[model samples]
Every structure is written in C-alpha cells, then in structure tokens.
Target: MDDAVRLESLAKSYGSGDSAVTALRDIQVSLPKGSFTAVMGPSGSGKSTLLQCAAALDRPSSGRVLIDGTDIAGLSETQLTEFRRESTGFVFQAFNLLPSLTAEQNVALPVRLAGRKPDRRTVQQALAQVGLEKKAGSRPSQLSGGQQQRVAIARALVTRPAVLFADEPTGALDLTTGRELLEVLRKLVDSPADDGLTTVVMVTHDPNVASFADRVLFLADGSLVGELISPTSEAVAARMTELAVPTC
Candidate 1:
C-alpha cells in the first residue's frame, strides 16, 4: 500500500531561544493507506502534537508533513485549508456538531462547505455507513452519546478523505459504547473495497482502544520511542508501563 501520511524529521517547539519548549523532536514515521494506528503516550509526550501536525491542523517548527505524498509545510494558509478539506478528515473528543442540525444535515456539512449542494443520497449513504440511517432525522440532543459520536464519524467519512485523524474519539463514551464505536472504526479500516485509500491515525490513551488498531505507536519526551504491531490490550498496557519508567 502507498503511504497516506509521512512525517520527516518533524519538530515542533513553542517559544524561542532560551525559553523554548520542544513538543515534538525529530519525529519520522509513515502510515500506509488503509492502516489504523493508535498513538499512545504520557500526558506531555507529544501525542496530540504529532496528530495535529500530521493532520495539517498545525504547522511544524521544522521538517515535513506529507499527506498522500504532498508536502504541506510550504502550503499557503488558504492552500492548506483547501487541501485539508479535500484530502483529510478529523474527529475530536467533542462531537462538535451543530445542536440544531439533524444527523443527515450534519453528515452533509463538509460537502456543503465545499461550495457544492448537499446531496440527500450522499448524506443518507454516509449515515448508513455508520449504521445511523434510521437515526438520520435525530438531532444531537435527541441522540445518545454514542449515537452522537456515530454522527460525528459519519461527518468525517462523508468527505471520502484519504486519511482520518481522530483525537480521543471515544473519550466521552462509556466502555461499552466506546467499544461499539471502535468496532465501527475497525470495520471501516478492515474493508479495503470501501475504504482502501483511507488511513486512520487516532490519539488514544486506553490500551483497549489501541488494541483495536492494527498497530500502536508510542511517544515519549517528544520523540518516537517505540512501536507495537498487532497489539493486544495486555501487550499495549505492558508497553505503556515500560515507557513510563525512567531508564538509566
């Protein structure tokens, strides 16, 4: 599979000179198309930084962020905005839906924002992909938390973007609901025919959530520290424990 996202010697620092605090340091990694990768780390280890940079939500201080082979480091603000909208999708801990909009309207938002008329059939298909077709008329207030999140996922998927960046997607849901959401995510990546060109990069602290991914990328002290392939919850938890301890 081709690479959907690549970060080359990426570095992000806040402030300047003597007061500078680096949040990401020489990070280099590639996520191939259709892969689901979970990023795990301690509170200050740059997990959020990595996702923000990779997804073009923020620029890096130095190095490159390549999305689908296009280097975004030099893109103008307007160019970056258009590129991001056309090529990438994002989901956050907060559903961030318009409370006034129903599920079908919410799913059609990206298309509408891109200056195209929202297609009712497209909206229905997107909601159906997330198993929410029957709830298409429900407003955010009317849906359960998991149902709301499913709507958010549908919004992300409707764009048919090359990559999906999810930051703590299930953070607000209960365990069972979170697992159900993860299962939905897993099915998306698992089905190459439907989502073969899409890649998923998610920031999650829970080992059980990470286990749903194809691999787990561990970050520490603003660096790419370790990786686990075909991870299970037990293995992911063990790796997290190892990263927490200071080594001599």
Candidate 2:
C-alpha cells in the first residue's frame, strides 16, 4: 500500500539555549493508506507533539512531513491551508462542535468552508455511517457525550481526507461510550468506502484505546522506542510495564 504519511528525521524543540527542550528527536515513521495506527507514550513523552507535527497543526524545528508523497513543509501558508483542507481531518478529545449548529451542519461545515456548496446527500450519508442520521438536526447540547463525539467523527470523515489524526478521541467518554466511538472509528478505517486513500493515526496513552489500532508505536523521551503489530490491550500493557511506563 502507498504511504499516506511519511516523517523523516522529524525534530521539534522549544527554547533556544542550554535549557532547550527537545520534544521530538530524529523521529521517523510512516502510515500506509487504509491502515490504523496508535501512538502511546508517557506524560511529556512527546505523543501530543508528534501528532501535532504530523498533522501540520505545528511545525517541526527541523525535518520533513509528507502527506501522499507531497512535502507539507515546502508548502506556503496558503498552500498548506489548502493541503490540510483537502488531505487531513482531525478529531480531538473535545468534541469541537459548534454548539449553535446542528449535527448535520457541523458535519457539513468543512466542505462549506472549502468554498464548495454542501452536498446534503453526502452529509446525510456521513451521519448515517455514525448511526446519527436520526439526530442530524439535533444541536450539540441535545446529544449525549457519545452521540456528540459520533458527530465529530462524522465531521472528520465527511471531508474524505487522505488521513485522519485523532488525539485521545475517547479520552472524554465513559468506557461504554468510548468503546462505541472506537467501533465507529474502526469501521471507518476498514470501510471499503475509504477507497484505499484514507489512513488513521491516533495519539492515546490508554492500552485499551491503542488496542484498536493495527499497530502501536511506543515513544519514550521523544523517540520511538518500540512498535507492536496487531496490538491488544494486554500486550501493550505488558510492554508499557517492561518500559517502566505507566499504563492507563
């Protein structure tokens, strides 16, 4: 499969002197199209930094980030904005929904912001995929946390982005609700409708959350320390224990 994301010697640092802190060091990783990967790390291990850098939400102090073979670092601000709009989707711990907008409107917002007219049918289908078609007209305040999160997922997928970056997507939900959200996300990654063009990368410290990924990348002290394929919560927890890192 083609690479959906490529990071070459990615580095990020804060401050400029003897006290400088490196959040990422010579990081390199890849995510292939239609694959699902999760990143795990301890507090301050650069998990969030890595996700931000990979998604172009933050620039690395050095190195490169490529999406679909196009180097995002080389793009100008306008071009980068376009690139993100056309190629990337993000789901954060917070629902990030507009309280004033209905679920359907929230899902359609991205396409609308891209200066294209919204396709009502496509928007409806996206919501349906998340089992929220019936609630499409409900406002964020009208839905439960899980239902709201599902709307966020729909918003992320509605754009049909090349890659989706989720940061602790289930962090804010109860176990049952989180599992339901994970199921929706897992289905989206494995969906034939993705057409071999979409990939998923999530940043999570929870082994249960990471268990859903096809692969788990472990980071410690700003570097990739290990990787586990076909990961399970048990396996990830064991590895975290071995690494002396606390498991969630």
Q: Give the TM-scores of the predictions, in the order they appear.
A: 0.97, 0.95
* Cα RMSD of predicted structure 2: 2.4
Q: Which candidate should be chosen as best, given TM-score against the real structure?
A: 1
Off by over 4 Å in 2: 194-196, 245-248
Candidate 2 residue-wise lDDT at 150: 93
Per-residue lDDT of 83-111 in model 1, one digit per residue for the tens?
99889999999999999999999889999
How high is the CA lDDT of each candidate model?
0.92, 0.90
- What's the TM for model 2? 0.95
For residues 64-90, write the lDDT of model 2, one tens digit per residue. Answer: 999888888888899898888878989
Candidate 2 — worst ten consecutive residues by lDDT sum?
A: 189-198
Task: Report each candidate's C-alpha RMSD, comma-separated, in the order given.
Answer: 1.2, 2.4
Among these predictions, the greatest lDDT belongs to 1
**Candidate 2 backbone collisions, by pair:** none
